[model samples]
Target: MWDYSEKVKEHFFAPRNAGAVDGANAVGDVGSLSCGDALRLTLKVDPESETILDAGFQTFGCGSAIASSSALTEIIKGMNIDAALQVSNQDIADYLDGLPPEKMHCSVMGREALQAAVANYRGEEWVDDHEEGALICKCFAVDAVMIEETIRANDLSTVEEVTNYTKAGGGCSACHEGIEEILMKVMDERGETFDPTAVAGEIKKPTSGLTNLQRMKRIEELLEEIRPNLQRDHGDVELVEVDGKYIYVKMIGACAGCQMASTTLGGIQQHLAEGLGEFIQVLPAEELARRAAMGA
Candidate 1:
């Protein structure tokens, strides 16, 4: 249940340029039924001036998609072909006032179709100028080029923003890690520095001079904070004891036999490290026992 803006509602209900132009010299098509959206864009261009004489669209998508295609045509009409190349997904969204975050992909579709149509007009192969990297988001068949372009165009920082603009990590969520990698890479390329874990809400370990007893107390406090989330999954954790930098813990309840116990343990350890200090390490009861047996 998304709230469509007045302009979105207007264009969706009565989409302008809803049909294609006959004998059009340039045409671009993108998306598919399987992808949940499709668009066919036809352009009539002045051969000498290279200005867009007319633009029309045949869109097969949701309300936002239709509005986006219609809006794109209106924006590019009477503009130079070179100028039209600069129109971004954000521009399309802005033209329609603003779109809901989830519906931003519809605008992305418009930009892609426009690029394709322009390429067709030039008699050149469609080339993405944003990214020349590997395919990261397989769910929606989005590659790094599309994701990177959207991020750069909109200055997106968070995974949520990437998902909003490109629909990359929105499905299945297996590619979230890959999306994060690309985000960091792009940020680095822009000479911006950030704590990589900050996107996931992970705090970097702070340096603090404290006694062993104080450190143990702090670890207990952090564990208390994380316990509630584990409890919701019928899982629980107990502090065995703190030995030097190693904070040993025992998994109980469903967590004890859960196949994902190791993953949960790693998450807990990472949380502790971030909250306390990187020096603080977490080990399971079994690991502690084995280490003690080795006399090391």
Candidate 2:
């Protein structure tokens, strides 16, 4: 079972703004039932002030999807349209405390709905067509442009992370290479190295077993290599615990509350997996504690 946070459960069981807003002037619809997720967002904006007077939504999907949509309406209700447009997928996740890594795509869907609604209000052409980029994920109808944008916004480095945030490489396993190429291109643009071995289907098994202490030492060394880059951004990562395949770390400084923290941890996990020649997961220390407290 997915370990849902209390806030997520709160919104899911009794979703706020669960229906269409009366007298809504803007409407945005995204996703399809065929894709297993869909959302319709309605907004009543004050024309002169351009502020969202009211917002509501109706979504079809899992609890995370419903909660994300509910949280989105609450987050944008009183904000100016311009500010709402600046809200990222990470913002929605943060609003709900956090989402399970596997369910991050639900937050991404919410962000897209908000953008579509704003564009509708503005009478701007908001096309979901794959005209700007190739169709990368046939299963999810995720295009290259969306994948690239999500990677850049979240600092995603591995195909698995991309799947977490965009659902791009999560289906059929055919788009893994395409996703890897996109990750490589984005990392290259950012002057960061992309480890091809980090691709979801290509990770190699550890050649030899090491003691827990040796594993911890190696993980620390790998983290030290990436510390400079994170430090430059006023963020840092601290090793917390090593439990089997899970490496728990604490994001310190500016990284702790960062909207992109999950993907930052994803990047760290990718680096460690490549260096250690093993498939491993990196998670936040807080998340570990939360699960333990819940007995999840």
Candidate 3:
């Protein structure tokens, strides 16, 4: 079962600003009942000062979604619209003392609503439609742009993490690969590496008879064998660490910046898995460091 923080429960049970604001001048509507979550945010803005005088919401979803919408209204009640646009989904989660990772999309919806409302007040065009070929998760109507932004905003590294933050791959699993590709692109932009094991979730235990040292030695030998091929192209790979089924390596030289780095990593992973007779995932050294920094 998902654990609900106390603040979340408080807002859910007795949501503040629960109805439409009287004399509301700005309105933003997002999500859909068919998608299982919908929200309508109404704001009363002082046109002269460009300040939000009041805010209210009506939401349709689980407890988390309602609480998130409530929290958003409370958060921006007295703020300027420009300042409110800076409110990220993480800020909403932080306001509620943090949300369950699985429920983060609630906060994301809240953020989007705020942007839409602000745009409405400013008479700016805001389009949230799912363009053809741009939609990434059909089940949730999540698009690639949303997924990419969420990944960058939250430093998301895994397909599961992306699902939790944006609800992109949470249904049917068809968009898992697309989510992973987005993750890789984001990581590459950040000059970090991604671990495919996290995406595929196919880690295997070490072979029955091989000791830890034996496994480590075999992995290093396989990496050594792979190095010469990379070296032929003025690139190289160096083993960094071995933890369970994950073998972390650093790609140096041209390979580090290669557009086909993921493909090269996949080749290395396939080679190691075949040689070791087990499912082994090749990861970039930066992935290990990122996990450490996150205390995960």
Candidate 4:
């Protein structure tokens, strides 16, 4: 039997908003009839608060997608606009407790439908694929604006909080520390104080403890240690950074072109991140490759 998250099991059985709204103020459609997943969301707004008064959805997909859509509706029925907007893919995933790795895409569809609905409400169309600020967080196909806005919300009280608010770090944890940096800057600007605590036992070297050259030397050593196994497979894995509990890496070789590159990067990341903290963020090599490609 496919192992379902307990939260997933509950949502699948008793999805809250399973039908369509009688008179919707805004409607958004995503996915497709032919696509494995499709969603139609009809929403009612609280004119004054811009809050969601009621919402309902119709989904044609696997259990996760269907349940997620149903659950999404229930979540937004009475949430204010800003708060509802703050409801991230992570929040949905958390509400459902957990999801299988392969089926994670299903829950993502629920979030997409919501984005489309909100875009529709604003009378805006989906932007061009190559438009500026359009880096699709490939794992979930979510855009940067979504991440930036999600991060800006004070809801993300700390670095890991973004994982609870957005599934960004929950994927190939590449941007884990980057997201944290963004949040830290935001908090500072708002005169908010966020803890700089590292995950227990994670290597949190003081800023002045290791000079730039020493840090580079340390990373080189770490890479050298893993170079053999990587070369055994005609590959190279480079550790980009070791921050707190997150160990970011870049993989080169068969992995660079492999369809499972993300998977490979995640496996490597998981191994390294675990070396430090019980809770570690492993970033994929693809992110580094992509950045390199862009920089070049």
lDDT of 3 by residue, 1-296 (tens): 66899999999999999989999999999884324698999999999988999999999888999999999999999998888888888789889987875576788789888888988988987776432236678655577877888889978788876764555676678988888899899999999888877543333655635889888888888888768767754589999988888889999986898766776787788668867878778999999999999998
Over 1-296, each residue of candidate 1 has an lDDT whose tens digit, in order, gives 77899999999998887798867889999873333798999999999999999999998898999999999999999999999989988789888987875576788789989999999999988865433345677554577777887778877677866764555675678998888888888878888764445554444545546777787788889899778857744578999988877889999886797665765676677667767755577788989889889998
Model 4 stretches with alpha carbons more than 4 Å out: 32-35, 128-296
The residue-by-residue lDDT of candidate 2 on 179-285, one tens digit each, is 98998999999999899666453556864377778888999999998888577446799999888888899999878897767667777887788778898989999
Candidate 3 residues lying further than 4 Å off, grouped into runs, are 32-35, 129-296
Once fitted onto the true fold, the runs of candidate 2 whose alpha carbons sit more than 4 angstroms away are: 32-35, 128-296
Q: Please state every model's RMSD to the true fold in angstroms.
A: 16.7, 10.8, 14.2, 17.3
Sorted by TM-score (best first), the order is: 2, 3, 1, 4
Report how far residue 198 has shifted in candidate 1, in Å.
11
Better of 1 and 3 by lDDT: 3
Query: Each prediction's Cα lDDT score?
Result: 0.80, 0.84, 0.82, 0.64
In model 3, residue pairs whose N, Cα or C atoms come closer than 3 Å (at least 3 residues apart or on different chains), thus clashing, are none
TM-score of each candidate structure, all chains considered together = 0.48, 0.52, 0.48, 0.47
TM-score of 3: 0.48
Who wins the lDDT comparison? 2
The stretch of ten residues in a row with the least summed lDDT in candidate 1 is 194-203
Lowest lDDT 10-mer window, candidate 2?
A: 125-134
Scored against the true structure, residue 250 in model 1 reaches a CA lDDT of: 96
lDDT of 4 at 151: 65
